[model samples]
Target: MALFVGLTGGIASGKSTVARLLSARNIPVIDTDLISRELVEPGQPCLNELCQHFGPEILNEDGHLNRKTLREKIFTDSSARAVLETILHPQIRRIAKERAEQSATQAPYVLVVVPLLADPKVQPHYQWLDYVVGVRATPAIQKARLLERPGIDPPLADQMISAQSSDRERDAIVNEWIVNTGDLTTLARQVDQCHHKLLMLTAERTSSE
Candidate 1:
């Protein structure tokens, strides 16, 4: 079995950037965010359940999920957000686990990017992960990065940031930390160092097994 590493961070904390850096070094990654998107495709059961709970208005005229509309609904309503998590989290976890298992045969280790890994409700479900790596950035940096994304404004970005686990919370659970408060070059160096550490850990685990 390969070492299963869970990568997590708050929105705009550079989780995706770190994942990309790891991918560039040829590490296999199973991203729950991508799996979540796949689970909600028009005809998927998860999408059907979402419509049942949130109404058909959440879907576009083309019958696909109107992500913006759904985001607006969930961000404003805590109950709605919990409902969304209830519907998608289990499915995403299952699929991500399956993919990680498949990738283990082809790589020294596998990275599973899960943005909510520090959530009290979400963290317990991912206990099978061998290690957890938290990517962190200052609130100022996070807000700036979030504002750069399309359709995100200051208020919405603040709401998104406030909804996630804080750096201290993440630090409590993460086996390793990647500080992402700097430029790409600095971030890449941290990733390189983390990658080397993971490789060594993987080799140690393999020999023991």
Candidate 2:
């Protein structure tokens, strides 16, 4: 199987930036965030299951997942939030893990960017990863950057943060930690370092599959 590297971080912690840099270097990345979105696409099984559990209110009139409405509804209800995660995360993991395994036979490594890898509840499902990448950003930096995200409300952003694992908790599972304590250029430099490390690790994996 491919060397499956789990790249994760807290909200606004530069996980996406890390994923982008890895992609730029021709490293294939299987991001759960993207898979979650795709799984809920109009005709997908995930969308059908979510509709049955959350009702059509979670969808826009166009039948797409109305992320805003769902965000508010679940974010305000702790149990509902967990229930949603229970439903969506399973499908997201299934697809990402499958693709990652497929990639291993063709390449040195596969990057699985799961934003919730640091969360205690989610980490258990990812122990098979060859490495775990922890990303960090100060609360101020996170809050400031989050304010500018498309369609994000400050309160909702806060809710999202509340749902994530703490930085202390994040540090526990990390084999490699990417720090995002500065500008984009600095962030890119750090990511490049991590990318090099990943490349070395990938090269070390035998191609015997």
Candidate 3:
């Protein structure tokens, strides 16, 4: 089985950067966010369930899932959020498991990156190594990173970070961390080491098998 790395981080915290570095090394990554997006396609089972749970209002004029509207509703309403999680999490896990199994037979290892890896519940079934890789920047630095993304507003970005676990808590949970403090070279080096460690773990398992 491929080593399942559960990546966690706050908004604009460079999880993508670390994932990209690993991808550049030819390693496979199972992104839950990507799978979540897939499950909500217009006529998929998940879409049907969501429409039933959330009503037809969750659909766009084109009859596709209106992600924007759904996200807005879920974010503000705790019950809505719980209901959506109840609907989406299982499907996401199912897709992730299938991908992980496929990857295991094809390669030595694969990473399952979840944005909210510290959610305490709903973590993947794989023996996932939680990683709290992120930018150790001040609030101003974080705001700059968020605003530089073009469409993000400062206040919303602030709220997004505040909504999740603190950096210390994230760091405490993960097996390792990659500090993205404007030093891309250092970040790249660290990710390299971490990637090999993951590969080594997978190699060990492969040999045992």
Best by lDDT: 1
**Against the unseen true structure, what C-alpha lDDT does each candidate score?**
0.92, 0.83, 0.72
Q: Where's the lowest-lDDT run of ten residues in candidate 3?
A: 126-135
Candidate 1, residues 1-209, lDDT tens digits: the string is 68999999888989999999999888998999999999999899999999999999999999999998899898889999999999999999999999999999988889999998988998899998999999999999999998888888999999889988898888878999999998899999999999999999999998999
Per-residue lDDT of model 3, residues 1-209, tens digit only: 55656676766677778888888877788888889988888778888988888899989899888766676676566688888888889888878878876776666666677777666665434344433334344556667787886545666566656766667766656777777776789888888888778778777877899
Q: For all the candidates, what are their Cα RMSDs to the real structure?
A: 0.9, 2.0, 3.0
Identify the candidate with maximal TM-score.
Answer: 1
Model 3: CA > 4 A from native: 124-140, 148-151, 204-209
TM-score of model number 3: 0.81
Backbone clashes under 3 angstroms, per model = 0, 1, 1
**Candidate 2 wrong stretches, greater than 4 Å:** 205-209
TM-score per prediction, in order, is 0.97, 0.92, 0.81
